[model samples]
Target chain A: MTVNGVEQVRDIEPRLLLVHLLRDELRLTGTHWGCDTSNCGACTVWMDGLPVKSCTVLAVMADGRSVRTVEDLEGPFGLDQVQQSFMDCHGLQCGFCTPGMLMTARKLLDDNPDPTDTEIREAISGQICRCTGYRNIVAAIRHAADAEAAGRGDT
Target chain B: MQVPAFFEYQRATSVAHVVTLLERFGPEARIVAGGHSLIPMMKLRLAQPELLVDVNDLHELAGITVEDGVLRIGALTRHAELLASPLAGEHFPILHDAERVIADPVVRNRGTIGGSVCQADPSEDLSGVFTALRAVAVVRGVDGDRTVPMREFFHGPYETAVRPAEILVELRVPLQPGAGSAYVKVDRRVGDWAVAAAGAVVSLGPGGVVEQVGIGLTAVGDADFTAVEAEDLLRGRVADEYTFAAAGEAAATHCRPVADQRGPVDYKRHLAGELTVRALRDATARAHRGGSTE
Candidate 1:
């Protein structure tokens, strides 16, 4: 199966989780596994344009699906608007939940470009940021929105 | 978490293939759809089957349609499809309400309704709502097809009446006029499993008297329970606050709950009563063409 614009094929066990395949086989470790159980959203990734918990998904389940990881977010110059906005707005301190947080935010914004604070909170509720950087996260989303509205680069 | 090493995997392309596989494998094998529930249990090593037959690729096992005033949902219909289905939103309001709050959006997208009903988790929302709505499960085996009422289909926690070789093919819920139903659940988070929930289906006569009342409770027993006493008490009565409160009390009295990690048994009882009252109130209000907000 092709992942993150790369065509790849390999035989895998039925028990091999997609997170393991993305990390161990594919050498893409950006998707961290904070909770092997489905509770924690640390392994969130976009499969076929919808956000799903990677830890809960089997590698076989993703056989014919398009997967987008945090590694795919790197641009020609620097970090994407969502990532930079998280930094500028202080959305992270421990950064354990950063990749999943960023991926979830990307899907949320794609669906609703100008989401309300409640919408942002609901979008990221699956992920738990231990440092409780929610306040700054919200601010950064708003800042990114403002930048987009002003036709300036996203902070 | 690793799936136990004992099981063998077989991906079947059609329903006949699944049936043949199951018949050949016998009771040691289980059919897997979506893998939202089975895979998790396998990872935890809670359920160790010798063989797993993947039925997700069977196209005949997925889809949604309405026929003869009854909504027929294929067994593999995902929660997301139900949420997005116009038939569910139009004909089965109780199911729509429950499906809207199941797990989360991602889980909803992948978790199949059949998988959930077959899993028979007491805390699952759809099972309770389906029971209250008097839905039927269509099962297919070597002898052909049989329809099992939702109440009879669900035996207990993690248990169903489906035979070892039979495949659950579809869920059928009748569409009745003058029927208004609502499901109310309390959870720590919006999409978490219910601490306790109640699905109330109330249809009233022209004189504003209840014609039929079906109340199903979850997270309070081994399986979704029909509150027969509550239904008997509310029949032919005006669905007022007093009547609903009485019905709620009756339902709570019949509930056999236990304390789990979420909360104490007493708290579940209290929540069950509150949710029952709330669901009835909302259902009645909707029947009268009023919004639940009131």
Candidate 2:
């Protein structure tokens, strides 16, 4: 599978989950493993351009697909706008749910471009963030959306 | 960390290939699509299949199209895709209503409609939606293809009429002219399973008389997820709150619900009745407005 714009190959057991493959095999620790069930989206990653819980997906299922993790958020210019917005808005406390939030937020901004506060909350409803009470996280996503709109002269 | 037990995996290239694999692996083999439901069960050791036939690559079973006044939804159609289909929503708003609350967005992106129906969870939303629509399930096997009514699809919780060596290929919902459908669920949280839910499809005749009615109840142990007695009482009757309340009472009195984490038996029964009335009211209003809820 192509992960974070790089192709990776490994011989793994069929029982191995996609989250474990990324964290243990490829060492892409950016995708956190939480809630073995798909309820908690901390293990969320992009599979073929859509977010899915990696913990519920088998590594073998992604055999010929492409995966994008939170580690790939950086661009040549430096930290992605969403990463910068998180720092600006204090989106992290313990930082355990930051990666998943960032990944989901990046996708939301890319898709909706200027999502309303309600939209932002709905998009991240699958993910759990016990810290920061999600207010800062939602604000961070809103900040990123606002920044993108400003860059595109939509403001 | 939860991991599935050791199993052999094979990606099926085609429907024929999937049927062949299933026959070769026998009852011990299981076809997996999306893996959102099956994987969790496998992780908890609830389901232990010796061979996992991955059908994710089968493109033949992945689309929603209408043909001959029937909406044919491929078994591989994802929840997100179904929720986003304007054609589906325009024809049956009940599908959109159910899909919107089936699960969270990310999980919906990966979960398949076929998998959800095949899993046959007693609390599954789509099962109740399909039941209310009186949809048909298309099954493919070595002999050929056959269709089964949604009312007879589920044998029990976690068990479906889909026999081993057969794969459910598509679902066909016949379009009913001047018919409107709606589904209502009450969950503790945003993405939790239904405590008790109800779905209804109502078509009114001249003078606001009920022409046909189908009511489906979920998580309430209603036989086949249908309120047959309630439906019989509503058909040919005036579409009014009086009849609707009677149907609700019939449904509530007949259903057998057990107490659990979500609610006590009486509360669930009350929800079953109330949700049925609400679903019927909305459905009747939509029918009066000419079918499309949008």
lDDT of 1 by residue, B1-294 (tens): 454455778888877788888899998898888788988888888887888888867779899998998889999998878888876777657887898678876677678999998999989888888888899999998888899999898877888989999899999988777678899889888788899999988888877788887888988873556777888999999889999999989888888889988899889988888899999998888777632222
Candidate 2 lDDT at A7 equals 91
Model 2 regions more than 4 Å off = none
lDDT of 2 by residue, B1-294 (tens): 688999999999999999999999899999999998899999999999999999999889999999999999999999999999998998999999999888899999999999999999999999888999999999999999999999999999988999999999999999998898999999999989999999999999999999999899999986589999899999999999999999999999999998999999999999999999999999999999899895
Question: Candidate 1 regions off by >4 Å?
Answer: A76-78, A145-155, B1-6, B222-224, B290-294
Give each model a TM-score: 0.93, 0.99
- The docking quality of candidate 1, as DockQ, is 0.42
The pairs that clash in candidate 2 are: none
Best by DockQ: 2
RMSD of 1: 2.6
**lDDT at B275 for candidate 2?**
95
| Candidate 2 whole-model C-alpha lDDT, 0 to 1 | 0.93
CAPRI grade of model 2: high
Model 1 local distance difference test score: 0.83
Task: Provide per-model DockQ scores.
Answer: 0.42, 0.91
